[model samples]
Target chain A: MTCTAKKCGIHFQPPSIILIYEDQNQEKTRKRIMPIRNFSKFSDCSRAAEQLKNNPRHKAYLESVSLRQLQKLYSLLKGHLKGQSLAQSLEQVQREEAIDPEEDMNKLDDKELAKRKSIMDELFEKNRKKKDDPDFVYNVEVVFPQDEQVESCGWDAESDEGF
Target chain B: MAAAGGDARAELDVDVDVDAGPGQEKYDAEENVKIICLGDSAVGKSKLMERFLLDGYRPQQLSTFALTLYKHAASVDGKRVLVDFWDTAGQERFQSMHPSYYHKAHACIMVFDVQRKVTYKNLSNWYKELREFRPEIPCIVVANKIDADMKMTQKSFNFARKFNLPFYFVSAADGTNVVKLFSDAIKLAVAYKQNSGDFMDEVMRELENFDLQQKGEDFSDKEESCPEEKPPST
Candidate 1:
């Protein structure tokens, strides 16, 4: 996807899950042909077992990492994601004229978009003051899920890492 | 043992759903699942949740006053999974008071910082808390902050073995392993939620040992000792 900003243009390669194809009675089909970009993300029996196999430090390495460590890693990534998003959004504004969020976000230059998002986020954070927890800090966006409506929302990609 | 089936019967008094087909209805899958994050304050709980919950993160102030909820939708391997994650505060005393907002979660995620030993030590208390409210939940353990120092990574591995919880070492700051942790937790949650049976006994057993409820009752020691108590069964 290509997004154009007033002064800065940016290109986007969506992480995944952009399309949905379903036939009436039969179950919806997943397009497996689509490449799974983040291989390291899926840590199940296979992934965990692989950790034991892949590295020489496996024994010693496994010793230190804990759930809290994962939690902190996630928080840090959220920051990374925010930066990526602003970049993507600024690109979006430049590319489309739809006036929808996709367009509105795309309209701003990267710096301008980042500035707006940062200002609002700063205002909320300062007012909310989540600094007390030092070892771990998370900024969560909570939205109520409506069960009845979800199934109908075509191409649901809510979990997209860059979402 | 059939008793395993019976005890499971007691533990499970959830409103039973009669089958859509002869016996097939019971095997019916749910469209939704609950995933909870538990950890200490300043350990990056809220920030991690925001990364996964929202499309991206905002470099703003973070204070987890109340439980924040986020939902995600995706397909794991093949099955469509909707993950409902709760980002909770990590303050010690607050940890106890909060999270009681719900019961019997499908999955639990515990996060700790690698550099700090205190966060590592508290995993015991956090694990105990998991057992209390949602005993049968599948847990994923994470070691955060690998970027700042490698020494902490050493500490992180040590912490993982103590709990035997599935461990992931990632740099949320650099965008490393962040997605993997989210994906894995959901997959495991779905796997465990679906196989509530295959692992049901194991989960109940874990709960028995780690149950904070039992520990809580013992600590309160408020039960009255009656000399002439009448048997209700009589």
Candidate 2:
């Protein structure tokens, strides 16, 4: 499929399409589903319940938060809570509270929420590197201008051409 | 231009001139042109960047974890220039604080809100600080936010007369003389990098000395408690 510019005469190349098959058709092996004990229940559900008593069901919440955040939340109630900025402590407490089982059943805003996944990914990477600043920074997204980006505008070959 | 018009906004995320360069081209060969904008809070540095980058320069809600960089590739005299831009905040809190992002900038733009002449007066401190950090880098002194009240339309070349930096007065809100200033800046950056230009450096040098008194710096034997009242710029 071709991607047309929303309004202008320009057209952009569509991203490459990937093909997937339900069965490993004559190739790769079949994957099996295995369950580890619901370890998340102890940390996410229980702690969230203990903190706020209200957690709306979220299909993506458990999958979204960083592992460190989960561990921190779990540990917040583990011993005498570790040293944390008031903001950090409150954020952890809220995440636990947000994961409670008997909360409301509203839907989630997926697009806005995906922003956190990247933040979580950055945090996990920073923790692994053991850096001084573990927060996700915008520099992580200093993207190289893509070919599609080049198609946008500037340097008219005619009137402004000494190029 | 899509900028001065409508319906073209959503459609164009970028504006590239492929036919101009036309083919598998090498990355711009010219040395990168780094432009840094520093000024007091809300003096419109970011707005200027936005006006130059995107037509709608919204007020930044949060500090960029670091400075912002935008790349504009252009070819002049068969040389390609990739302009790397840095836009900074002018809050006093950030004044002495090291810019984690200001390492090797090639040129600097010290902006002031034209409406607030105090901002205009203090352009030197910003210039001094940055020059102390990168002496050889060329600079452009810009008076911004010209769209607001201008008690009178007096042509105050006061900012320009004082310094050697190329001085420009622009209203980013209305897009008055913005592109010309930007293109001129890039041209100056190019000339400086190649050591082929005189006007830019010459202008900036005069600009530096012109506003010394206005900046509350005493150039006299004893620090002058009050500056000699020079008439406004014409």
Return the TM-score for each candidate structure: 0.42, 0.39
Task: Give me candidate 2's interface root-mean-square deviation.
Answer: 22.0
Model 1 agreement with the true structure over A67-156: per-residue lDDT tens digits: 222222332333334554554544543342121222232235555544344433332343332334454344222222322332322211
Pick the TM-score winner.
1
- What lDDT does the true structure give each of the candidates? 0.47, 0.44
Deviation of model 1 at B30, angstroms: 0.8
Instruction: Write model 2 residue lDDT over B10-102, tens digit each, in one string.
Output: 322334431121111111123456666777555666656666655223333325343444556556578767675556443333454243333
- Interface Cα RMSD for all candidates? 20.3, 22.0
lDDT of 2 by residue, A1-163 (tens): 1111111110111211111212324444332221222233234533442332122332222333334343443444332234455467557655643422221111224432333333323422433311133552211211122223233112122322221
- CAPRI class of candidate 1: incorrect
lDDT: which candidate is best? 1
